[model samples]
Target: MVRSAYERGVTTLTLDSPHNRNALSKGLVAGLRAGLAQAAADDAVRAVLLTHTGNTFCAGADLREGSGSPAELAALLRSIVELPKPVVARVEGHVRAGGTGLLGACDISVAGPGASFAFTEARIGVAPAVISMPLLPRLDARAAARYYLTGERFGAAEAARIGLVTLAAEEGADGGTGASGKGVDALLEPVLDGLRRGSPQGLAESKRLVTAEVLRTFDRDTDSLAELSARLFASDEAREGMTAFLERREPAWVP
Candidate 1:
């Protein structure tokens, strides 16, 4: 579920699926892709704000949904990568796995002080797949390799230090101030105001320049992340993990 609103040429998109911790489901991802596409095509939209509901910004892909057919997941990720407009991720809470991928794809990201990030795919016995392409650019190769391999959770400060987050908040400040719960509104206000003040053409151009560099740096090495993803989805480990999760039991893979 997503809500979109335009004000003073800025489009704000909110994820509204609090029930599943806003895990990215196929329909939700489709809506997001379509919304971003529309914003890219609309001259009136200068910048975009991406935020979510609940304490967690996004939990990740809905593993309950068959790991989403690989073809669909690749298409969705590609749409995010190719979106021409400047998109900012407003991270107010935890973001893990696929959620981290979405943030990595954004042009800019501002996070609340309390926000935490993780790449937990390996814990469940699967690779990050297409998500790794985007994430690798957001972080140093060593850091990316370490986290991707270990599935370790990191806090907001560490996230910022590692370049995964651009701004970190302190306590008691505006909701946008980078302070846990309080600084988000403040942080967004100035950023949104600045966005409104800038020329849309310049903004678009800047986005293109930066994105080009990122693209060059993190271009998908293999032709088909989806093909690899399909193999992983059907792997014995993934099958067992998914079934165990659905059945509300610990995976046997755990020692």
Candidate 2:
């Protein structure tokens, strides 16, 4: 599920399905799309803030739910890229596989020390195909190659250094300032304030400038990537990988 709340000039979309660790199940994807659509239509909404409700921002697609449609996933990422208002991601949890694609789609992303990220598709006998549209152009080529190939998980600080996130809040920081002195909210306050101050047209145009290349990538590669994703998910290797993962054992290829 996706929940929404508006404050100042930003509409916050919270991914709230912790059952599957907020995986991209059909219901969750539909909820997110509706939330984004609502934000797009709201004249008062200057930006969108995307965050999640649990320890894992998302654990990629829900393998139990058949992973949804690759084409639909591609469209969802494209919507985030083509959103007229800037989209910001606030992460204080682990992000894996397809979840990392969301970080790439956002205009700006802030992750606290609690946040970690990984392109885990390779470990499951698939490539990070569809996600590469938003990621490849933005990430450090060398780092992308290393992580994508090895399925290595990296923390928020490393994520920032590699351009996977805009900022990594201090380890001492809490998701909100509350009991902690300076934190994730502390890091995001200024940015959100700045967005609130920006003129509607200016913010929209500026967002366009920043997102154009990503949109172009979506246009040029979405079809091919979606095709690749579908093919991979349907393969026997992926079957073994998913089964091994579900059964808590090493896949045959691992030995």
lDDT of each: 0.77, 0.89
The number of the candidate with the highest TM-score is: 2
Q: What does the lDDT come to for candidate 1?
A: 0.77
What residue pairs clash in candidate 2, if any at all?
A: none
The window of 10 residues in a row where model 1 has the poorest summed lDDT is 173-182
Off by over 4 Å in 2: 172-181
lDDT of 2 at 17: 95
Per-residue lDDT of model 1, residues 1-255, tens digit only: 988999888888899888788888888888887888888888888788998878899888788787876566556665666676678888878898888888878777888767888887777667888776667766877888888888788877777777787766644534444334446566677778888787877876777777775566345543466677778877989888777867888889787
Best by lDDT: 2
RMSD (Å) of each candidate, 1 decimal: 2.9, 2.6
Per-residue lDDT of model 2, residues 1-255, tens digit only: 999999887999999998899999889889999999999999999999999998999899899965579999998999899888889999999999999998899999998878989998988898899989999989999999999998988988789999999988746443443234556888899899999899888998998898888889988998899999999999999999888888999999976
